[model samples]
Target chain A: MDINGPVESTVIEERPGRRRLPPQERRQQIIDGAVAFFAEVGFDGKTRDLAKRLGVTQSLLFNYFATKDELIEAVYEQVYLNRLAPDWPDRLTDRSTPLRDRLLAFYTEYSTLIFQYEWMRIFMSSGLSGAELNRRYLKHLGDVILRPLLGEIEFAARSGGTPTMEDIWNLHGGIVYIGIRQHIYRTPCPDDPSVAITRAVDRFLLAFGVEQG
Target chain B: MDINGPVESTVIEERPGRRRLPPQERRQQIIDGAVAFFAEVGFDGKTRDLAKRLGVTQSLLFNYFATKDELIEAVYEQVYLNRLAPDWPDRLTDRSTPLRDRLLAFYTEYSTLIFQYEWMRIFMSSGLSGAELNRRYLKHLGDVILRPLLGEIEFAARSGGTPTMEDIWNLHGGIVYIGIRQHIYRTPCPDDPSVAITRAVDRFLLAFGVEQG
Candidate 1:
């Protein structure tokens, strides 16, 4: 099984020149490169190849991150976790604004964030990794993201009853499905996120008897 | 680096005995095993390992399927292409049945077919394969499955204009998303597929102003 190949000769040949940068810039660059690489090759990708892609020695890449597991965790944080801005939950539940407008706006932004090729690739990769990264993310979504949105919807609907998680999932899942169809399956969604969100919100409002303008 | 390991020594050790079978039976067995294996480890899994799992010689496995590529195509055919019954399209458009009933029944059956761990895992694996298997499957789904369902919906609704593919995608995508969340993401859907399909169909009917009992 040992074909005594050059240490990743192909990766080295592609990018012969290496740049010297400050540690902060170098770390960011590594994370960015890792995002694209891991999205393409998944968690099983060789760190040496990733180092080669960065035009750095593998040991030098390890200087910035202690291990491959750490690098992948960084990828999860950078691509999936960090993409959620601090103001998102606040913007979603801001009762001062119209519920319909907030719903449409929040999901439009959320869809835009998650539907990118990099995010979806990494998402599918993590799901396939058996590492429960997606499960952990979904828990975070339920607690930090969807719960607040549902609370706002419940408050706005004024239906005098708390909506079940299933109800919220039905609504939010419809929006997420749009991304899956467009990004994952490569289906060209005729409506942009704005249109899709509005339609989903309209259907949800109609189905749940939530009044809206 | 040459350790000189036996040809798949570990896999062979896992199952020391091999069974000899007729060509047709062996071929089907290998395809079936490959579906479960690929669904589990994805396309990157080793053929020798799959042979071990089936208790067959690696060369014998290769004899049944010329290569890993052929084995995966066999997987796509077995898991996806062949699963759709011929009566599905007719059932979707069967005006003799109520449109709501037909939509719910069709989706319930479709969801049942695809929501299994094998089907969902393989589907996600294909999506992440970068081979556009999902796109190919989506095209198959669009042409063979969703289009006729939409035509039936429009006919039943008596909507003067044809519904665009996007409109149909919205309705159908929501149902598919339910499967993704529950099956792929391991989200425990509170309602069964029938309940979820009924709810989605209800929203769709509401959106299109279709009358439902």
Candidate 2:
């Protein structure tokens, strides 16, 4: 059972001999194509279009991506920039900054990136929660920063207990989900001018004992 | 100049018989049908299907919705529950429990509704942000919540202590923009594990001074 791209439709399935490129190049092609496509057409955006962008047969495309899911995973891997996290392990040693400000730096940078790549929300909302690629991507996130950042993230999740990988995951998702609704979904809200991301961070920090003022 | 549902293409028109039914009933009918259609078929779902569900013809669908824009407005009206927030000015003063608990209640209820109507994200991620429906809906929100909560929200905007309506609107859009990224775009973090709504709330709270542990 090989993972695939776009689930039902793989463009390059039959074009095995179309070209010979480095694995890195081919993978980048798929990632670049998927991001641009999603940015424009969103989740329902097609794979054939990606083939068109690459100027190759659908089979050749399939040879690289296998399925849209695979392609999306590749896109997630390529585009996500977690290496940029404000040194969660040691940034706060500078006790001069308020705890809230330090937390905001981490959050603002993360949310800014997320907000900048608007199509990222569409990718997650595409009912692909069950996909192996998405799961792996999430697993990577857990391994990278969350397991070690309990004390820091405590200001966000609101509970002092060491958060499990899943708790951390859900906490982040909860923030992103509501943010999508308020901003992307254009859902209404009270005079509370805070965006979903800001709101999530606000609650998260409060949960962790960050002073609201 | 005519906008009709783009069941197959970019949606551009509305249901044809809007004026035939009484205004309230007609509005309700269209809202119910549109929400169902978006939920069942997603952003690309057919408006014809919505009419069929209502036991109406494709052309008759235009009666209730004159253009695709009109129908989307109906969907926004139903799905965007922010208008309901001001019903509880008491929200700001609810000491029955901690502010955290009250806010969690607000965030949970709001996030749950969005989750159930997953299309809420799709409808937004469609990149049809420039539509009149979107503007009208936001204006309505200002009327219901922002106008009344203007003073507090203005201060929240950090707008130099005195701001105008446009300033508040800009700040609000920024926050909502975050929601769009996390929930609608579903950007994955390296550490996130599950797809819960609390994370969104926490982020929202952090953006403002509402939540504190």
Candidate 3:
């Protein structure tokens, strides 16, 4: 059966010329399109529609992704995993820089990546759909990002008591909420989130009995 | 054409002998079921499926709610608007209580209402689907809840600077993220969030140079 019949009239035919591209470039293009498409519609969107939007035949689209799940997996990697800076863990725990400056810098970079319309919508969509994407990303965030920050806070504290994981998550959540407000809730947020991020980080350090250096 | 035909076999026939409920009671029942249903399947779910789940005929479901949008509006009222305590604003700005204590009390009560699985999931689903429900509720929340709390903070600040809406949003978002982690991310959170709430409120006050009296 021809699942991809005539293209829907609503879909704009952007690729009228249909210029041939290299295999790797074509694969990257599909993944980028999938990220935007899945963000607009939830993951439940049909592959036929995606093919139509991409101006590709369903069979050709299937050449790269055999299943919708495979396509979604690629979207997950491009949208979520690839955005995590590898050296973020290292930079977060660098004792030479004050924890305050490190936090500001890290969140500045992190927010720039995750605060996009597509990223925020996809994250919310996955969570609502009960997909494993959010669970996995959050787990990775805890292990790679929050855990290292927690260790830094524990090292920096002037008082004897150790900081808990919840403390680190609170600071992270506070910073991330700025993006959530902008993209998810569609509310007014600061044009630049550094001000809010700085306040949250400073308050977190103060609560931990760490004086600003 | 009857939209709802025979009951699906997969749906457990709990109401073998449907006991007739009074008009108001039946309306409440449908709204309650809808809150759960939409939270699970999202607002895009069909009325036929909702009737099947509720063990009611589609005609019966339509009697109370003329259209799916109407039903969704009712669900919005039940799940979102009804949860806001009217006196919360008054209590938050009572001034008799210390700002820290007031914040702790407000969030403790606020989280209790919003931290439930149904509430969290529905909130997320609505936001992702681009429904007006979240935007409206958040606006109401800003006016009725956050505005009062912001006024209280500004009143209590020992320093000259007045707190911005972003400041209050950060504190609220940090406290609310505990629930989002539990319900949205399906992660373990503190059994009692009050401890975390207390810590957050104290830190917020500390940032403003308000002594914890």
Candidate 1 C-alpha lDDT tens digits along A25-69: 989999999999888777788888988877788898788888889
Give the chain B TM-score for each candidate.
0.81, 0.46, 0.83
B69-150: candidate 1 lDDT, tens digit per residue: 9889889888877777788888887788788888888888888888788898888777766557678777878888889877
What TM-scores result for chain A when each predicted structure is judged separately against the true chain A? Answer: 0.78, 0.54, 0.83
Give the alpha carbon lDDT tens digit for every residue of B68-115 in model 2. Answer: 767876676666645345544466334656554654564445444444
lDDT of 2 by residue, A50-146 (tens): 7777776667767777787777766656555453454654664334566557646656566555544344544454433333444455555555555
Task: Provide the lDDT at A63 for model 3.
Answer: 93
Please identify model 3 stretches exceeding 4 Å from their true place.
Answer: A1-24, A57-64, A159-162, B1-20, B46-48, B57-64
Docking class of 1: acceptable
TM-score of 3: 0.87
Error of 1 at A3 (Å): 33
**What does candidate 3's lDDT look like per residue over A1-213, in tens digits?**
223337654645445556589999999999999999999888888888988888888787889988888999899888876878899999998888888888889988988999899999888887777778788788998999999888888888886366678877877888888888898888878999888887778777877777685
Q: What does the TM-score come to for chain B in model 1? A: 0.81
**Decoy 1 TM-score against native:** 0.84
- The alpha-carbon deviation from the true structure for residue B104 of candidate 1, after best TM-score superposition, in angstroms, is 0.7
| Candidates in order: C-alpha RMSD to true structure | 8.3, 13.7, 6.9
lDDT of 3 by residue, B1-213 (tens): 223457654655545657689999999999999999988888888888988888888789989999889999899788776788888888888888777787777888888988998999888887877778788888999999998888887888887377789888888888889998988878778899888887777778877878796
When sorted by DockQ, best at the front, the candidate numbers are 3, 1, 2
How close to the true structure is residue A190 of candidate 2, measured as C-alpha lDDT? 35
lDDT of model 3 at position B99: 77
